[model samples]
Target chain A: MTERASFREYHQNIIERVATRLEESLPAQWQIPSSLREAMLYSLMAGGKRMRPLLVMAACEALDGNADAALDAACAVEMVHTYSLIHDDLPAMDNDDYRRGKLTNHKVFGEAAAILAGDALLTHAFYLVARLSQVHGVPAEQVVNITMDLAELAGPKGMVGGQAADMEGEQGLTELSQLEYIHLHKTSDLITFSLLAGGRIAGADEQKLEALRTFGQKLGLAFQIQDDILDIVGDEAKLGKKTQSDMKQEKVTYPYFIGLEASRGEVERLTAEAKSAVIEAGLADPSRLLEIADYLMNRDH
Target chain B: MTERASFREYHQNIIERVATRLEESLPAQWQIPSSLREAMLYSLMAGGKRMRPLLVMAACEALDGNADAALDAACAVEMVHTYSLIHDDLPAMDNDDYRRGKLTNHKVFGEAAAILAGDALLTHAFYLVARLSQVHGVPAEQVVNITMDLAELAGPKGMVGGQAADMEGEQGLTELSQLEYIHLHKTSDLITFSLLAGGRIAGADEQKLEALRTFGQKLGLAFQIQDDILDIVGDEAKLGKKTQSDMKQEKVTYPYFIGLEASRGEVERLTAEAKSAVIEAGLADPSRLLEIADYLMNRDH
Candidate 1:
């Protein structure tokens, strides 16, 4: 219980730090048109668990690197994630009315404004990274490499490709291999990138980088399977969303093909694999990463 | 007559080169899902004037920089331009049926695919810039600066801000200042970035950079005003689109406030100012830039 409490505190610390940075990163309202600023700030400040930024900060901390150096990147990843969520929830996409228990960007701002807000956020993410590279005095080579990794990972071959596949899959039958591809690219890719980016920023050596990459990939898969399980079993009120949405959407998920028990087992196995990779890499204080993995595997929401 | 024909030939050469490079810059079909790739390539390769890329090349050439070095940047700019066009033509935005005489992206592909394509292209543009920085062994610092410039110019404070203003202006009374703000940001900002990016790649002196900046602003305004004029008077077949779109949409345009003759006069004055800025910068062979400006001023299609 004590360990769990401490882990929660640690997670809270990272989240708070990231939240402050995010608020600071946005331009002043006076600097931009009121409506655009409001729309952008609306979704930006809507506040999720901020998992991506936490990964960045944690990765930096694990490597004994400067957490400050990772702040812009941390905020940048969150912006990208937020923008993806906005677009994904558009009338043309998932068409969700609520996200994080609040109205989606388009629900309040209208379709055009929502789309522009997403674009602004995405474009602003890179801008923030570039600006921070200068402000933090990080090497441009490192920043550019990081930027490339981000763009490629989030691009057509990565997240966008997965999304396109998912959309196409909806109109037809989906295979397990296809579902895995979708999971890997759509969700796992960005998660892996978040961790990899953190490790990269910390100047982790190649072996360490490889270990983080492996850990991230395993953890991401495990996380998604847990989500699949949650969709089936999670409390609607607690989760702040409808349960079994995938079933309603006819979206293929892990539990749909494999049994619920088997999906849970898969999550356990993947979580163990992630922890082992972290230990094998000999990351400084793997405790936090392990705790996060455990928390993800056990998370009800 | 001979000089005019040769100048036309020179512009055509740049346009052709840019078009080819734009094709090559996209990820191969194998790299991404065919549907996503097709959607992205469909708009990217859609034949247009390739003005932004040409500006990058011309600016680089004027500074005696290696054109090859700017090729990636040139292609990058076009990707940005294409992505903007895709989003701008969305039903939520302009709702245009045709662009470059072909069906808009959303018309051919579904809205979801179109949105994803634009997102993918925007992400891919940065990816290309990062890759080019490595492939060409350019200094990371320079690339980071360039990236920063691109992001800011295209992001909220620049292009996105302009778009937001344009959308907001549609609902309320628009003042001349508001219209200028929209035009400067929505259209001129990216154009300026293209030229400035070229100059930066060539390591131009501050004076030269300023000159390019000034030239770009003037040229962009002239180009937009000319577009306004064309929308009023251009032949449908030659323009490859229906004219009077601004009037139909009730978009605030230069010819709407200023008389048609005055708008034409503004284009002429701005074109001359652009040319003079180029010459004053002592750029080598200002002929192409001047010719481009004149072409923009005189173009009916």
Candidate 2:
């Protein structure tokens, strides 16, 4: 096989693994109300790039950790990501009718179910991490630490805080720094969580974990800037929603503050910084992490 | 002071402690967005009976556990309870303009802020529990257990599931069993979490934990039935809500199925059974729990 074909297969393998685990993440034996279960699964099973989960597994793999052991953490990050998307699409929030090329949770299940589903997903993500000790024999201290980090990164001062700022910015974004704050917390915090969690699962030291955090932060910002660029210049069908929806909603983005060319340059700079952080950390294997960083930088969607 | 006055003082002490902790619970050092923090604290500090946090402390005390050690768990349970109230009062949910004698969260903060505030509270609740190990020196294993229980009891198959069923039931009247299911999950699960968490914090064994579970299930159901009863006969001034509002909403309740007299009798019966379980467990001191049960039973609003 060609070198590119081999890389494609490696990436595809991780995606399939994450997808299957996520599909099976919700407990079937528990008496989950049918409609609630359906609403949660509908948006969860709806395919996205699975970017957050992929970052988790890749970070773990870079540490020469067992990717299988990191699978639950991988899925947990995605669950948080999915819940955010569901809530972000609520009528009270963005009121988007579609996500990942499919109808948004509230659009399909109505607002109440949508709200509950988002809540359930967020709650369940913590449950998965807590189970890591019992299921994967991760140390109790590590589990506690991982759980704490997940909550912090996703909680009020992190992703949710970012979301609140984003909504406030909707009225009128005053400065570039305000827009960056929204992206960092709303988008970057959880991505940072994915990498740090994977590193924790792999028993990486504090210094290595710090590296992962920096890498995740830079990469997340780059990915988000690329999203803004795509919104203005990309194809609608491939992008899964209407292009220029951000402009229509009057949402201020990176490209809005800085021109498209500057935004693209920012993505490239951030991706390079992200890869450099991982490489300097001297992980067991950094090839996959570096490759993923480059892939995120150039992705059309 | 008279015996009644002393009892009032005792309850007041616990409430004051929990209220102070909750007021300080949001990490001031963290970069929580100002408006989001205000929205969260608004609903949280809006006083209720403090029933759930009281249960956590009371149950911990019953097992000779240091109430101080259990405070974080107590605050965490109240956070979950408060978040549920915020979301339940949303425009898409109960659509209430008032809660606890003040404007509801969505009414005060707008729908988007209310939703994000609720999300922040829920996520923060887990963060608090995860900190128990660090703050109180609770064993990591116990912290893991508490975190897992908190998620399961509060997640889809528990409180959120019951909420979904309750919303579905709004479409039409349902059988008594369906109402019971909703009551058990929506009302009972988090209460059960409080007791079990307290027991775990106190280092209680499995048998005592089971006793707490049974006690919580019975007491929680009784509490909900009492709520339904109050909806009909309650004084609006004391209740801080409209009397017969359940009827206005066409909500099916225990009184709607069984007569008011029968519902009152059921509450008494359940309270007795709940106290019996705790008494049979031979806890360090069951008096507080027993008193709390009776207080819940006789509460007018």
Best TM-score among the predictions, by candidate number: 2
lDDT of prediction 1: 0.85
Question: Which candidate's DockQ is highest?
Answer: 2
What are the per-residue Cα lDDT tens digits for candidate 2 across B106-141? 998999999999999999999999999898999999
What residue pairs are clashing in model 2? none
Measured with DockQ on alpha carbons, how good is candidate 1? 0.77
- The candidate scoring highest on lDDT is 2
lDDT string for model 1 (A1-301, tens) is 3544587787887788888888888767535778888888888888777878877777777888777878788899888888999999999999999988899999999999999999988998898778757688766777887888788888888888888988888985557788788788888778878877778778888899888888888888888888899999999888889999999998889888888998899999999999899898988867677888898898899
First chain TM-score for all predictions: 0.95, 0.97
Give the range of the ten consecutive residues with the poorest summed lDDT in model 2 chain B: B1-10
Model 2, range A4-38, lDDT digits (tens) per residue?
A: 44556877877888889988888669888899999
The candidate 1 chain B region of ten consecutive residues with least summed lDDT is B1-10
Model 2: residues >4 Å from true position, as ranges? Answer: A1-5, B1-5
**Worst 10 contiguous positions by lDDT, candidate 1 chain A:** A1-10
Report the alpha-carbon TM-score of model 2 versus the true structure: 0.97
